[model samples]
Target: MESEALGHTVMDQRQGHGSLVAVAEKLTLEEINSTGAISNFGKPNAPSPAAIVACVPKNVHVDEVGETEFRISPSEITAAIKAGLDFGGAYRC
Candidate 1:
């Protein structure tokens, strides 16, 4: 959904530009009972795990836990949000 949000922003910008077009996708919060959702598709600056994952390199590997669900900590989400804020503060994006 975060990725979808980013796409929405792109699409909106395209829409604003003359002779440009973009197909915007919708965001949904389905099946998000466990993992903490920081879904702010309309706000790209928001801490979107999906967006971060999309922008970063995908060479990351973790312990194999096939077809398993996991819990997310609020502290972790807070930390990520802070890091994003800090990066933005430093870079003035």
Candidate 2:
């Protein structure tokens, strides 16, 4: 509900504004895997955050984000997103 309300307020200001649009073709799993993250894992069901952790700049205080880091699983993220959706309205297909 809050995010939707914010979106409505922003739309009111935009009115008739137009923005640049970019389209990208769908990429195949083979193409995505060719980049190397899953090149060894076989077909990854979903990209793992840990796979690219090395790319992130080494943090001297990485422990600051300890609990919120890799410990949280994808199921938890999905559940949180679903809970937020429930606050807006009963989700109806």
Per-residue C-alpha lDDT of model 1 across residues 2-61, encoded as one tens digit per residue:
768767544455457543323222323343422333454335685645533313333544
lDDT, candidate 2, at 15: 47
Listed in order, each prediction's TM-score against the native is: 0.29, 0.24
lDDT for each candidate structure: 0.47, 0.44
Q: Model 1, which residues run further than 4 Å from truth? A: 1-63, 90-93
Number of clashing residue pairs in every model? Answer: 0, 0
Looking at candidate 2, what is the lDDT of residue 84? 58
After best superposition, candidate 1 residue 2: deviation in angstroms? 21
Worst 10 residues of 1 by lDDT: 19-28
Taking the tens digit of each residue's C-alpha lDDT, what string does model 2 give over 14-52? 443432122124555555546543323222364434432
True lDDT of residue 89, candidate 2: 38
